[model samples]
Target: MTRPDVTLENYDDVYRFYLDHQQNRLLARAAYAALSARFRPRVRYADGARDRLRELLSSDTRLIVVANHLSDRDQYTLAATAWRTPLRRAVGRTRVLAKDELFVDPGLRRKIDMMGSIPVFRSKNHGLRAVADAGRRMMDVSAQRLHRGDVLAIFPEGTCNEGDPTRVQRINTGVGHIAVKARKLGTAPALLAIGISYGPDRSADVHVAAPVLELPGTPMDVTRLVTAELQGAVDHAVAAR
Candidate 1:
């Protein structure tokens, strides 16, 4: 299937295309296998972090995993690190919320699509007024995916933290909105915040927190909860590094 153009005009179709698409499991595993040998060795987790994540994955509870973005390579690092832990269980089923521009390159887009990435139209790129409706559609599809039992991985910071990698940037309310929408659709999703930090040896330190099951009343309130959890996760990752 030809991918729809990642433009405002094709936004709806682009998202819908991925929503119904089933990834080739064999291909997904192959890709992970190739990267794991390199990344698995370089990535370390906080003590008990792996066990915490493993327990969550063992349950029927749906997860919304949010992480702080430190670099463009964060996704790759996360992917590789996950392959060594329980996170690899959600490999083919996870829908990653990625920025719109990542889909522009045809070559990379195929891999992105196969990895179950959903394009996110950001207001910074298209202007607030322009991406308003399209953003809603993105969130709706995300919520629907969650309701369908797919794990969602998002960099709630939205962009890499170029200034202070130690601190988690302000998280957007989009995450909260998606979780709220999923809840409305009868899916009680749990939040899992992961923190990533690079060490002097270039190894990655990843800290995964136990899932936060209780959410606050409004979207903003949920966002605040996520903010606090993510910051604590980041601090753990840094200290571990």
Candidate 2:
């Protein structure tokens, strides 16, 4: 089925498009294959991480995957690692929250669509007041997706941490908001933090932390927890690299 053509001008239209979006298995498989071939990353899940994730994938518990921002290539490496690990189970079932600008180009949009990306109108790109309503809509769509059994992935840092690759930058509360919304929608999402580091050997090292089942209620509290977990995961990835 051909995906709907969404200009992303109307927030409601964009929300509807995602709510009704169909997963194209062939395209998703091809993209994952290409990512695996392009960047063959070595993945190392923290002790019991794989088992914990397996349980989550097998259960009805939805996961709000949060990761640190390292480089633009982080997404590619992360995808490649997932393809090589148990995360491949969620290959076609995950919805990634991506910046809206990435959907502007037709060619890139097609690839991103195949990857199940949900366009996010970030306040950094648009003024806080301008994107406020749209941001809420996007978060609602995201929560609905989770409630409907789609795994949600987000980069809490919002942008690449160019200052220090080893240290995780301050996380934006957007991820917290998404989690809180998901909880309100009765999803009660679990947190899964993945850390990525490129080693001196030019090999990508990924550290998947154990899932956090207990989540705080407020957005600020959730953001603080995510920041701490992500930083720990990143520290492990850097040390193991």
Candidate 3:
């Protein structure tokens, strides 16, 4: 049977299918490494970030990596960074959140799906009820992934920043919502912040902010903490350029 067309209103079903039929890990890793290397990102680890990551890995803690989106290739950059660092051990279980529109293109969707991408429909693109429903499912799926011990790398800003490279755009509350959900679930994932800067030549400087060691009670609390951390990482990375 031919699959039904997926729209913003019903993309959740499509996402569920992909989640169940996850991509091949070996293929995903190999492709990620090749793409990231071609993009040629220089990853800079903040003081103790590496050690902290290793510690988290040693204890088998799942990670929720948040970052400022710079370009369409940000996913590849972060994938390459993880593949090159101690986080390499966790690549097999890592999943990146990709906007739903990317999944609508046949050729691109194939590639995106193979990269262990989870589909996300942004509320900003739709009416209130549909967006609200999709947004809730997105957060629930994110929290579920964390509960399953998968590494989830997300762009909390939900899109690339076109205005100012050094300044982070207004973040959506999804990250905070995910954190709050985790709080209630009693299994909060380790929150990691990242900042990436692209030069005129397309070379990237990626910075890893120190992970938030603790989560606050409210969604706004989590939002403030992650926002401040990401902003700092962005500024530090841009200043280094």
Candidate 4:
């Protein structure tokens, strides 16, 4: 059976509903804090990781953090590790471009939404209009956030490449679209490519590479460069294995 078509309206409605649920928000934050603390010790950063990240995140500049996806647990690890540095200030305030399927579960949905995740539909069979609408929604808000100097994080791979060790998948160009729109609005956010790789036994030792690109540039150029850098980081991490 084919999945139902998802539109930008669906995303807005669900996100607003989740946000209105205060109890869920409170519980989710508590859960996130607990999980982060539990796995804190196992998390490790490369030399100069903290300083480099701080320098990148310290700016009032708008940002889009594009990282490689690995597993469901990877999001939490990324969030937790990021929280350890100045990046935590962007939490709850920043937007995360995520998959639409995550909204299916009330609990998980609430948690992620509370964390400022914006769902992006990834249906291969879906019409172009639907995809465009979703992109428009993201652009509208993302541009505003950029104008306001807020950060936004996105996983350019769209989904986890769990078993693939040799290659990174082709990235959707929507990130480029968002950047272009934001720039046109006179608020182009800096695109930061981040590579996240799991450690031995997935024990929470996440290797976070520094920002690959920081200067403002054209959307397509930024997208291509960021993807290349992120892929290179993943390759290096894998090679060390």
Clashing pairs in 1: none
Off by over 4 Å in 4: 1-32, 41-49, 125-129, 212-216, 239-241
Ranking by lDDT: 2, 1, 3, 4
Candidate 3 — which residues are off by over 4 angstroms?
1-5
lDDT of 1 by residue, 35-131 (tens): 7777653445556767777787788678899989988878887777667778888888888999989899999988987778899988878889999
Q: How big is the positional error of residue 91 in model 2, measured in Å on the Cα after superposition?
A: 1.4
What TM-score goes with each of the models? 0.93, 0.93, 0.92, 0.78
Cα-based RMSD of the predictions, in order?
1.8, 1.9, 2.0, 4.9
- Please give, for residues 71-178, the per-residue lDDT of candidate 2 as tens digits: 778778877867887777888888988888888889999888889999887777777898888888888888889989888889889888889899988888888888
Q: After superposition, how far is residue 167 of candidate 3 from its true place, in Å?
A: 0.6
Query: lDDT tens string, model 3, 121-189?
Result: 776677667778777877887777777777888899987888988898988888888878866776867
Model 3 residue 108 CA deviation in Å: 1.4
Q: State residue 90's C-alpha deviation in candidate 2, in Å.
A: 1.3
Decoy 3 TM-score against native: 0.92
Which of the predicted structures, 3 or 4, would earn the higher lDDT when compared with the native? 3
- For model 2 the TM-score comes to 0.93
Q: What are the lDDT scores of the predictions, listed in order?
A: 0.84, 0.84, 0.79, 0.64
